[model samples]
Target: MKRKSWMLGVLFVLVILVSYMAKPEKTQNDLLLMNIEALAAGEDYVPIQCIGTGTVDCPLGGKTKFVMIGYSLE
Candidate 1:
């Protein structure tokens, strides 16, 4: 029971953090979405982007290389 409660608390914290991180100020588009994913080592990964605010521009379907050596250091 104790472990279950602790797990629940942790999950609650995680959800709160995720929501807090995603929460952004109101902009012109009414909906702004941002997604970030870590690329796999030695593998090519593409970034999925959605633009809402006109202030910043993002490249659609952008690709980034993840080197194993560099990722381990960070």
Candidate 2:
């Protein structure tokens, strides 16, 4: 029983390490769901400081590692 518990603990640790150490997933293909209009408001230029990809859903699909900087009129 103790050995089995130890094995399970080790398995859990390995899974966690694999996930954390793995590189961030990406979408090489252009996601049609993403567009300028969806990102911006109007003629205003949105200051996007940083952005990252996610699960690739739609309409801001998936998770976004994004940060806003400032705004302006485009």
Candidate 3:
């Protein structure tokens, strides 16, 4: 009886671990939606945009243009 119970406990733990591992990862679109939600909730700052294509007028004067690496817009 004790051996059966130990086996059941191990099985339960294995099931839980398998479910966690099978969970889906968030896509970039999901992240973008989350960011939009946060911005709508006033939890995030507005992203700065460039004024022009040229370096002289780009970055909107005093605004900082951030280049995020390892991030995809897709």
- Top TM-score model: 3
Expressed as tens digits, the lDDT of each residue in 1-74 for candidate 2 is 99999999999999999998896877555555456546665444454454676443333344556654676745
Q: What is the C-alpha lDDT of each candidate?
A: 0.54, 0.64, 0.64
Q: Which of 1 and 3 is the better model by TM-score? A: 3
| Candidate 2 Cα misplacement greater than 4 A, ranges | 25-74
Q: Which candidate do you rate higher for TM-score, 1 or 2?
A: 1
TM-score of each: 0.33, 0.32, 0.41
- In terms of TM-score, how similar is model 3 to the real structure? 0.41
Model 2 TM-score (2 dp): 0.32
Of 1 and 2, the candidate ranking higher by lDDT:
2
Which parts of model 1 have CA positions greater than 4 angstroms off? 25-74
Query: Backbone clashes in each candidate structure, one number apiece?
Result: 0, 4, 0
List model 3 lDDT by residue over 3-49, tens digit each. Answer: 99999999999999999999999667988988898788852334545
